[model samples]
Target chain A: MLYRARDLISITSFGEAYHNKPYLDRGDAESTAEPVCSTACDGASKTQARNRYPLRLERLIGRITELSGPAALEASCGLLREVQRRRGVPFVWILAHRLPPFAPDLAANGIDPQSIPFVFAPQPVAAAQAAERCLRSRAFELVLLDLTNQATGTNRGGGDRAAAAQRIDDAALGRLLRLCRQERAALLALTDRHGDLAGSLVFTRFAAARRKGSGRSGARERGGSDSCESGESSADYEYRVTLAKSKTGRPGAVYREVLRGPHGML
Target chain B: MAHTACCNLFEFALQVLLRRVPDWEAHPCVALAHDTPQARVLGCNAAAAELGVQPGMRYAAVLEFAPQVYAAGVSQAELHQHQQRVIAGLYALTDEVLCKPGDPGVLWANAAGFALLQGSPRAWAQQLSMRIERLGFRSRIVLGFTRFGSYLVSAAAQTPAVELLQSVEDERRKVAEVPLHAVVTSRQSRRRLARLGIRTAGALVQLPRSELRSRFGADVELVHRQALGECELPAQHAAVPVQPVASRRPPQPLISSEQILLETQLLLEALVQCLPRGECIAALTLQLSLDDRGQRRERIVPANPTEQVAVLLRLLRLRLERAVIDQPVSALRIEAELCRAAVQQHQLFRETVPERSGKQAVEAFAALRASLGEEAVRYVQLVPHHLPERRVQWRQGAGSQELSPRGSVQAQYADCPGTAQMVRRAFISPQPLARHLLRSGKLIGPYLLSCDWWQSPSRRLYYYYVMSPASDESTSALWVYYDLDRRRWMLQGTV
Candidate 1:
């Protein structure tokens, strides 16, 4: 029954500022037609729904994981723009070992490379240090850690290489999470997919989910079947974002969107 | 009678000569020689004097006497230039200043009716001494009723300043006590006087006038007359016009880093104090002489025009830290150039700009470059390109332009509607993978992407979206791409 209700809310809230509007407007008779036994009961249910699918824009202090591909890049850029719009003067810092060459595509999609500050670290340790220092200063509002190169260890041996790579990734993620919590700065860690899948693992301090399972919570877009109607379309790519950890909203929440552009822009 | 004050700077040639050879001063056995092919020793400091080096000895002969002695030759041109600087500096104290052509170290000024402008003759003499000192010369001042008497008193005074002789009787008493060498021009006559047991002026006066005249000629007679205050010598005022003079002194040789840093700080402070009102130092040039006689020069321009001593010192410290000094520094010279103070607009009520902190950050970065080497500090520069990786470049050192904007992304992309927000994780190199199956979900693939046809043939790629088999959850997705030309499936990145 709860799953059915959650599906209804997710479908109706797409591209709408439903979370921003007041849950119950006293003058609106349409709100009263929802068969409310009591005003307190209706208010409680409304609050519960809001908490289950917190607006992505309002989740300022959280991480966004880009499941690796061109589609992930496009989605991150779009999310960055959204954050910038909502915060007004949000200073975003992109910390990476090396920046990809698709900056022009980002510029074409209205994400200016010149507008974002990039801190390049030659190694993973350096990137971690830079991110920690940048966040501690609170000089930047959003810090994106490009772990794509860092998470993949050099293939020196057969079994040890994979284990070592996983260890590096886990350590980097743990350190970044600690820094984000201490500074209360939003940190997103991006890594490439090892298989034929792409998705985001978001770690946020705002919404702490009570559920324990790893099931998809809300708003899942199926595939990269979306058509490219306008702008420069390079390829059709789809991405899914999962709220892996949150301090204020549902932790296991997920959202999916398809991007179509020369560089995977929506 | 009008009183004349004479100011004599001791070792003027040696001081000015030391500026060119910084390490020579540290050698106890060092002498200045005239710049002739023969190179006759003009003056020897106490160190050389102790080693039997005497004035007028041939440079080669002095080396024979003390092979360890360091001999530096002073050109006539350089000596004359230094002499003119000293005269011009003293000229500022009085208009009626007389500086003899041969005696470049001494200056005679007519203090007659100008006592009120200078407080008193003694005060005027002290002021003149300070002015000469500012020109990097050590000076002694003497005041008397006659030019020769003043000269005698200045030459007799071992200390930097001598008492003023208010009357002719006082001048006569002081002159009688003066050594004969102080009044006599000829070294031969002074040596003759010493041989005859007449070392003091009083003893010279006691000798029979006919005998003195017969022994030393007319010059001895005039010297005796001047010593007795019987002959009055007029001051020969300088004919040349006075020009603005700048003082430059080579700092004492400092071997320790602490001493070097301290001396640099003092120099910076002095430079700041010398700056004109409403002006600050724009650039500084530091010239250092090494022990091996090699020279090292460094020029530093602050990120912001600053008169603050601490800021300048900090930058210098950084520079010194990174500088590789092969030998101990023997001398240092600091020169500062002035510029109009930087003017910044201030918001009336609220803070609109972080100009002060921004400037400090730039200065800090400069210091970092100095301490950590030039490659330590880096800044990002964006290049216009279609390739995502080639579009950004990191360069060492801060550029003049402002740091890239931080919050303008939204306005920049506002025109592009329905743009999917995404972040791409780039791979160092795309990892090759084999075609695999997914347990949690079916594979979603073959999305093709190809570009850059001009440089190379257009390479085709087939991308697929599948769930990781190790993870049971259907939510986890991975992106895989197939390179057609390479004929291989590669894990491009994770979504």
Candidate 2:
């Protein structure tokens, strides 16, 4: 009961800015905050619902953000579209030379593949530099610096750590953070789900991973909700994003988002 | 961390003549690098240019086109003197400036933090132009973000006065329109590009960097990179131009490659010690007296000026490996040009204050495009095709607009009502699909994907490869397919 009271208190403060309002006051969302709160509700398995609001990424604006996990790119793509479409801010995506994210999929996910610009850096250092250049040019309102070793064949522990160090150092992050604050733009650095690679001055760091059963190796969830598609494996997979660290104080808070329909929610 | 401006006193020698005669400005005149008929035209006045007298055209050839064109020659020493004076005038406005050696008349100045001191970046540029104009030479100043971008803008601008390009797209579009001949120094390379029908900077960029360099020359490859705007600029540290000479006379004549490398290392180590208080060695001119077998000379320039001995040593080792050190018993001399200047003098002019444009983020960066070539920065577009791979097409850099066809769907916000989903890790090329089938039993596939869906024997059975030995479904899985034509398995992406 005390835990439930704490959740009520949190819901009051975190949702204070909204007070059951639509994102950016777009006037499309329901006045009742039930739409967004339905999906990622804490301590209530019964709260899982058939519909929910778009994942809220406005919380990370003007921040030096890091997102990692199995579905990190998906979460980031959603954030980019949200900022780009709703807020009307231009953004640039810097990718590794080898890791070419499927553009059709990105377009399906609400991004105007034509509207966003991509910079290909071979290493983390180059990605950081390109991000810096875009920030300085004042053309982009958001910068996505993907330092994940998607191109590198090695996904083991040691290599990721070494690559992270080489790609993202304190000096580079310091400079990027200052620019984000000064320009009031968002900088998102993505990495593999594993490894503690968050650097200093990151205002918010989170991981968007698929929520599994109970343990390291547990069975898939038995029951399903209405929004989930037909068939066992074909249904939209639900992903849980947990805050790893934050300058905003909530370290363990989580949010949930679901995949689009098979034909991209058309 | 502000904008940079390029101050080009076009045709220094011609400008000098016009200033001295005051009447030459109205007449057709050309500044000859040499007075000989065979010598090329270094600079030409508007009147001369109007009469088809072009820079780099032979004076003898110009005689046929414009016989009345006046010719004058300025010595190298005099040109250097004027360049130094103009650089000096520029320093009065900004603290840092850069210019290539032997390539006088054009210089880049740091144009940041002037909104308070002067006004906008445009005003700072105006003051710079006025200061140079006060020196009696007409010039054009373009203020923009990168050193190369700004210089290109100033050189190619149609308007005569100062032009300010503030956005990245504007600078890229303007740079793309510059003709190949204006930037490329070699006439042979320019002709080679012209023969390929690649007239503009944008067209040259479409050609691969390595092929362009191999076929045309190193100069042509450089212009191609610049047009893309992804190229990392070299270090901008030049002041009080100091060339420190350090030499070594081996006690005995050596006959081995090892001895030469050892001797060179010692010389470089010694050179490192004597570099000025706050300057790094920019370039090293290594002259070896090869036992009266003539002198073997090589000038080694680091990507950026550095005081670190290791970085300098690595560059030296690379140069030595390629160099033939067959001859022995010689003296070695190394001349190092100063990379950066002592900041004490600059500090005196202005207070050390934090910049408003944010940390070094606004600082120009030699990014991925610098090493990976112009295609380094690219965007993807989905084309309607049966083959999954063929559906994706790549477009490079910030092209002014999309290359979509007529009646193609415009990508708009209103169309996409749902949030964006995860993107698979797509490989530019497919990798081998191995070890997944043998390990995990939870395979979902045989969707029967095919490049040519109508009727093609080259068919594929696609699958979501669950790498985990456990039966639980993972968030992200590898995307693999078995090809019927190749009779093998290949990994395409992650699902």
Candidate 3:
């Protein structure tokens, strides 16, 4: 029973475009027909089948496991990292064109930055690690991309500045999109409300009842003193989330998660 | 080194010097020896006659007849130098100079441009002859408007002309009475003629054209033309192209990377100049020398002749950079020859279009790999997993085409986990079945394979799975199988 009931969660019209398409549902059908399913089950036990909608994480993981190689997983890592950052992170309006400081931090949380893996690496060590592990060992659970700083480090004034700008622009975003489209890894890219993630499924954050100073929720607790700056309150930063892109999941549904986190995030 | 009077006479001189002269280089003359004691003189019978000495005359008889006669040896090097100097002088008159080493110095100069610079063509010949005489060499010079007439006149006259052909009138006069030997009579033909009482150029010229051709073949027709000075010579020039010039200044008197690069650059530049405009290079030759005592190694690189200097430089750089310096090239010289031009035909619509997808894929892979690591990208291929401890896989790159025409590989599992299980629970060889396996109790498996005959053979086996449930380690699946036909047990793989 590869068919899933199209009820349960309220799928926005936009979300239906991502998962309700015939092609999107066909992936599940293909997975069911794999010869490995018979070998894995040993064809001995009878199990009850359940109807599900919009596909589940388990099914997506299976597909990802089947499609992903080192390169694909590396791309997924970039997407997932973006998603994590978009959930909740501090915003410092710094124009410095260099890799952001929290990239390693995000990667440490199991968000791969590359399709493969490498032990002794410099920048994007997490990407290398993911690539090596995924490509060589054929093992990848998920991939996250954090593009909050994708635009940084590209404004170096030099020859053919426009061409350089365009190339960099495409690389920062286009590579991520292509990776997700081709790889089996489930990509989750996150970005702020105003920041453009190029190709990603956007979601909104909820307005919390717990005030910033009161620190009622865990997100508020994380937002410590000195979190507010320049007379503008944390509430002033509107958290707008919308699904920009989704291959196997909902896209338009505005699933709101609060921006407030421990130690301060906007 | 034997001296000679003319390039045309070089062969005659060589044959005479090598056979007749005992120490041709040292003596530079042949010593005349006879039964009677006679003063040795170097001249042949004809020369002896000029000195009032007959062939059979004793040396005393020659002295009595011509007491002032001077006997001198022939210097081959002097003759060679004289020929070269004549050639050089002729080149000063025009740019087209063709001198086949052993051939008579038959030069063709285009007087169309240099007629005024060199004075009248007749004067030029006289001046050329005088110059040769001043060099202590003898020469003859003749000129006409046509090459055939000039050749005939020069052969009939005493020497070659500075300008072989100058005008129509001069050509007509010189060509009217050419000697038969100038046009026909080779050694064998001459001997045959002699047997038939035919002697002298005038006599052969007198023979009827049809009868001469019938009896003597093409030689008769050649003689007839030469006699009438009607044979046409292709218009050519006389110019001694500068001797190919190459020099090397090596650091530490040995080859170095910098030196190699510089030398290649210089050679390429030199070749660019050597090749005519619009002409491309067909081939290039590079010769390297180790040192004063080093051996010379020559390398020939075939390339399209191109007027584009940059292309030549690039090619040279590539060749030099890849050159293996077996011995330090203390000296190097490069020469290039012209080749035919290339003609390109384009399709209707295809232009200079770049391959976008392929380029992007590779660059993206490279960039990601460089920024990330080598393991950043991976390929997926199908392989066999025989046992619990063993797993085999293939590598398929992102750009690799799926369904590689190679049939899908299938791993067959046995029906029952018996002794066959033990055999299956072992390492499966990816390589061909080199050897067979057996067990203590019963026949288990046989490793069978068929593959690339050149590389190795592919293998197919009936594999079985044996599991150890209680081990602290993960359940190790062992692939065991039996060669049903061979009645043999073979352990193929373990996972």
Candidate 3's residue-wise lDDT over A205-265, tens digit each? 1111111122222122222223322122222111112333346454443211122221112
DockQ of candidate 3 (2 decimals):
0.02
| Model 1: per-residue Cα lDDT over A134-174, one tens digit each | 55544455666654542222222346454344333555556
The interface RMSD values of the models, given in order, are: 8.1, 7.5, 23.7
Error of 2 at B239 (Å): 38
Cα lDDT of all candidates, in order? 0.56, 0.64, 0.37
Q: Which window of 10 residues has the lowest lDDT sum in candidate 3 chain B?
A: B416-425
lDDT of 2 by residue, B1-495 (tens): 347787877777787766656777778998887668998888887788889988888999999968998887755545655666787677778788888555687788877675348857777888988899888888888887887777777777765699888687788878788877667878888887788898887787788776877898777777777677668445445464434777888989877766777887888888778765666665677788888677888666554556666756665665565456777756989888664443443354755533322212211222233333446656676789755677777765333233221122224323333333446666666777555443644456667765655576568877765556363435456677788888888777766
Candidate 1 chain B minimal-lDDT segment of 10 residues: B241-250
lDDT of 1 at A146: 58
Instruction: Output the TM-score of candidate 3.
Output: 0.26
Error of 1 at B403 (Å): 5.8
Candidate 2 Cα outliers beyond 4 Å, as residue runs: A1-36, A39-58, A86-88, A150-161, A164-167, A211-233, A261-266, B1-368, B398-416, B419-422, B435-438, B453-457, B469-473
Which portions of model 3 show Cα errors greater than 4 Å? Answer: A1-266, B1-89, B98-104, B126-138, B158-180, B191-206, B233-243, B246-261, B264-495
The alpha-carbon lDDT assigned to residue A85 of candidate 3 equals 34
Q: What is the DockQ of candidate 1?
A: 0.09
